[model samples]
Target: MGALFDHLIAVPILLPLLAGALMVIVDDRRRPFKIAVNLVSTLTLLIVAITLLMIAGGMTASGDPARTSVYLLGNWPAPFAITLVLDRLSALMLVLTSVLAVAALIFSLARWHRAGPHFHTLFQFLLVGINGAFLTGDLFNLFVFFEVMLAASYGLVLHGSGTARVRAGLHYIAINLSASLLFLIGVALIYGVTGTLNMADLAARVGDASAENRVILEAGAAILGIAFLVKSGMWPLGFWLPTAYTAAAAPVAAIFAIMSKVGVYVVLRLSLLVFGPEAGDSAGFGAHWILVGGMVTIGFGMIGVLASQGLSRIAGYSVLVSSGTLLAVIGYGTAPVISGALYYLVSSTLTISAFFLLIELVERARDAGADVLAVTMEAFGEDEAEDAEEEVGVTIPFTLAVLGASFAGIALLLAGLPPLSGFLAKFAMIHGMFNPTGLGDGLPIGAGTWVLVALLIVSGLAALIAMTRSGISIFWASIERTVPSVRVIEVLPVLGLLGLCLAMTLQGGAVIRYMDETAASLSEPAGYIESVLTAERVARAPSGTPDPAQGADEETEVAP
Candidate 1:
């Protein structure tokens, strides 16, 4: 058991991979058993995630950052082998993804899991790819994991057939396939120039790469950046996001809140690693474009929110806002800004996930489509309706009160209003925008920083105004507003998500500290490289190439 704990990094990937495969073999008639497998797997993943973070933070029984886990596959050298390394950044992502998996899976159990075939299988595979992407240290392996994630997503995006879903799925599939092609092309160019697919090796080689190779690397980086930008929902390229997300079932959309962030994660990981201080003239190769593009993305998303009519569209635009803000923070590339942005990332993701789940419940009362999912009042496990049989009264009842309360919390979070995590996150970001030192001696706020500041405020205001309008339209303006019948399972997941956000708010200091540390670790890549390139890391890894005496029996399956 003690030894097993040392190699825990691989479990996030393996657990999901195994579970998804088993789910594929399980017949759909075994619904209860399927749900059990999914629930147990996701819950266990949540546990593993927390453990990985604790281990990284030195909060576990083994206490040291040097003890941060690295697993090399095939027992090959780092430059040639596949590797999965869990640093502060990757560990943080695993924890986040797991928490979301638990919430989204529980929410889906309410009904969406039964809506189509192999929903459970696809979901677990999605997790497998996402976890693998976050963990892998090799760029080629990253591509493989990306394809797995995308392939799974193609099925998920079309899980429940509708004309709109089919249309959106087709567009989504086409764009992503093209993006994948770009991703492959970029990887090929990088590998051709550098002769290594391992990210650590790439970083180690980049600083000293030849002038001609630098040109090749730059082009490869540009092409790769396009793929990431498209995935992250950066302008023009992300027009498909709103439509696709809106058409997706509630639970799918809820989980997809993290999809855009995956692109940001890759860019953040690769950019600083490959182009940091050690990279000489290329130290900040693409920073300017990222800065300009992030601002433009924010502007585009804001406009979409203002012009949107429905709740789903508004939520879709919010993804853009979240993505743009994170992209801009990455562009800023300051430790402090990245710190605050990390907190903002958590706050906004949980807030939006809850909002997506909540939207289905709220819309069920207003739209006939939602009514299709409606069941008897007893299905809610309540003796009676939250209100007096939908007859409005002077005093608010359980359903009304809950929706109102959740609405207020979401509004505060999304709008960055006071007392909530959203407000705290934005305040931290705004305060750190210039990194003030003394009364007259703060880091001089740059013009671009000011622009970011203005956009932050404007985006918050746009969100506030839009949310308020939607709330009134759904909650108050409708003279004959029917109370939505929500199941406890469905509502519990939303509450769990929002509660997590609130908990993050209550414990902002520790969380922010972790984010700060994670940012610092990412900003400097030396330690990360050292951890991956050690001889033990490459020559003695348990999962990759085996020694000659050990033979094929010792070797395990790795992605070809």
Candidate 2:
């Protein structure tokens, strides 16, 4: 039973891969099979959630004061073979991924066919890649999963293949492909320096390396950082993001919200583990650069949001802003700050994805296909008198009204309003930044403090103004046309997502506590390395074989 549970680490990544393959063969004409796939995807998500709960419970029982799980593939030894590590951080990310997956799947139910053939297939594959990226412990494997996800996303981005979508998709592909190249180069360099790919082992080796090797390591790390930054839509590197995300179908864009976070996850993981405080602060390489980068990203995204006219584009830019804010929090490198960042990550994922979904509905109602200019023109025309009334005072479907209100709440929360998860998340992070604690020791406060305060004020104000403008355009501005009727199925998914956002806000405290624990676990990598390597060697030892023989072979190999 214990062995069975250990293997469960692979389930989150494997189930989606298997489901994706099966979806390709299942007759698309059969609605039953499609429903089955959705059910299975939901079940897979449940399984992941259960696995996280178990991991948390085990940590409680161990009395070891650390929460970590490691699964070696095919009973192979770590540092020599692949391993899947699930700590508080990875488990939390897994849960977040699964939550978003289930929500996106539900949202796509009615719109899947309309999205194009093999919609379910692409979606499942995307989930597979996402889960795999979160679980894998090898750097190269991470790149492989990233490519898989990117490939699936390319199809989803250009799913309908309109001119705007195709153009945006091309831009997206070109930029990401370049990032992939840089990723490969960086990984190759890191491997050359350390001769190991496992994250835990790399962290151990990086900590022990000489100053010269450390320089090489940091250089490679920077290159890898650039790749992730590009993926996360950091300023200047993320110019393609808004166009691409806006051009995607609504359900597809909802999934994309999860997609962008993968990069942020990687950066956070690497910064804390492979480049701990000792190494990072040695040459001013700690979280300072990340803080600066995050602030710039937030500023640029806010400007983009305020300036954009299209609802979808506005939502896209909002994603950038959220990503920036989360990154800034992570860059603070404090337990409280990181915890708050994790909470924000969850809140932002749900809220932003819901926002995109709502934007789609709003665009459809306005008869504007990612064209803000056209929608704005129609809003003022006398021919759209009925639509104007519907836009402002009309009776929307109950579900849609709920969803709209939910989106409004998310926007308000993101702008740092009180009584919301977003506000709480920011408060925790800021508290950690200004008033240093044990977890926050060694973090530079002089420059970082001023930057954090500036970011808070500027981002909050910008988000408030942009969100309000968008709300007026979407829900209040007069329309010279009749809006489309909201579909019943569509209403259900939107409302479900909205409910999730509200729930997160209501339970902010508990969630932040969990996030804090997760961040602390991530900061310490020794437990992970020892568990994986030790368990793997024991599991792989031949039945009835004496330990001395295995030890002799390893000793002989290392001696000369």
Candidate 3:
């Protein structure tokens, strides 16, 4: 069982790749078969992810102190071969990705899949990239995974084929191309200076770099960060995000809520592991920049949320806000804060994704002409009189009622209202910020801490106002609009996502404890470096027979 679980670590990447390849060979006319394949593969991935998460958290019988599994490709040693690492953080991301993939896949069955050719193939390939990026142990593989993800996303973004989608796709392509160029250049410079691209090896050697190489290294890191920040939807670099997200198909948009976090994840991982306090002179490098940039991003997102008329745009800006909050908390550089940020990360991602999926349903409930006229009137400052008809009792259909309740729930979550995971997440973060070391210690609160606190409060308020206004316009003011015909398939995914948020709220203690442990591991990365650098290749049996000393089923397990 342990051996089987060990091999399953690689399944998140391999299963998707195989499924996508098979899907490509199957003709597009046979989409039902392809969909079935995709669904099965995704479900398998979800199970694997949960198992790996348990293993990483030490909930399993694998009593490895490090709680890290390093899978060396082609049975080669680390720092020389490609490797995939399974640890607390990577496992967490895999679970999140798989859950979202399942929800999005189910939602797409409602018709979004027919909007494009090779939708299933692209979707599976996208998962491959995302899963690979999360698990890879080296820098070059990260780049490879990043490109695969981006290439698939380009197709997904343009899936529904409209003028808006085409326009947004082009801009999205051009900007990401530039970012990719930056990524390559940064990798090259870092490798030239450090002579290593394996993340673990780089961390081991970075602190010992000469003064001259250190400057070049920092420059490379900064350039690389710019690329990540662009993906993270940071202020200046993310102007394309709203339009592109708004144009994407509903399932695509829903999954993309995590796409932005890919940058945040990389930044967080590298910053703590590579440039940590152990990096000597380079300790805390670029952290202040990240802090300030994140705050600025939050301010920008707040404004965008307030200014956005369409719910899709509001959701897009909400992504930026979530990213900024995580970045800021990461820059604060405390284990406690990171734990809370991780909690917030999961909460906001689920809420935002649910919001994106729900938007499509809500928009369906309204008349297209009515939507256009509402925007037009608001834009031209035309004040319309309210209907003065006497109050008449109206029966809300079960569909609209469910959708409205979901919308309200999403709004409350996004706005950090009480009794929801979103509120708890924010509260946890603020609590951590105030007590950076611990509540028992006496420490002066810094100005940056106060600034971050203020921004969190203000952003929540902004989200509340925007969501309320949009809800009223869609549900209340548009009384004459028809109730959208919705299938159970579509509604289930949205409910599933929101239900997860509620689950988080109920399981807050366990979640926070897990995050705390993950954060502690991240803070002290020596264990990660050691686990990767010292990982062993599996021993081969001679003469096509297993050695008596080694169990036949356990040959693939990492050597003790």
Best model number under TM-score: 3
lDDT: which is higher, 1 or 3? 3
User: Tens digits of per-residue lDDT for model 2 on 1-560?
Assistant: 26777778888888878888888888777766876886687666767666765575354544755446777665556665578887777777777777766766776776654557777788888887888898899898999999999999888888876899899999999999999999998898888788887887777677666778777777788899899999999888888899999888888888899888999999888887777754443423547778778888898888887787777777888889888887777676777677778877887787788777777666665645434654456467446665555456556655445645866786776687777777877787777777667464546678767877788767878778877776665555524344546677766666766676678778866677677777666666556667765653444356786543343335311110
By TM-score, how accurate is candidate 1? 0.90
- The order of the candidates by lDDT, greatest first, is 3, 1, 2
Error of 2 at 398 (Å): 4.2
Q: Model 3, 1-560: lDDT tens per residue?
A: 36677688899999999999999899999988998999999999999999888778875356544457988877666677688999999999999999999999999999999998999999999999999999999999999999999999999999988899999999999999999999999998899988788999888888998999999999999999999999999888888998889999999999998899899999999999999878989988899888888999999999999988789889999999999999988888888888899999999999999889998988886665665566675568543445344335667789989999999999999999999999999998899888877522223588888999999999999999999988877876675658888999999999999999999999999999899889888998999999898886677667778444334234432321
What's the count of clashing pairs in each model shown?
A: 6, 3, 0
The total of clashing pairs for model 2 equals: 3
Comparison by TM-score, 2 against 3, better one: 3
TM-score of each: 0.90, 0.90, 0.94
Q: What's the TM for model 3? A: 0.94
- lDDT (0-100) at residue 393 of candidate 3? 68
| lDDT string, candidate 1, 1-560, tens digits | 25577578789998989999998988989989888888899999999999888778765446445444677676665555678888788888888888888888988887888889999999999999899989999888899999999999999999987899989999999999999999999998988888777888788878888898899988998899899899999887788898988889888888888888899999888878988878876788897788778889999999988777778888899999989999888887777778888899888999888889998888877865332222222136434356556655566558977987898789889889888899988888887776744112223687988999999999999999988877765665443457878889988888888898889988999998888788778777898888787636323446675464244344432222
The true-versus-predicted C-alpha distance at residue 357 of model 1, in Å, is 0.3
- Candidate that beats the other on TM-score, 1 or 3, i.e. the better one: 3
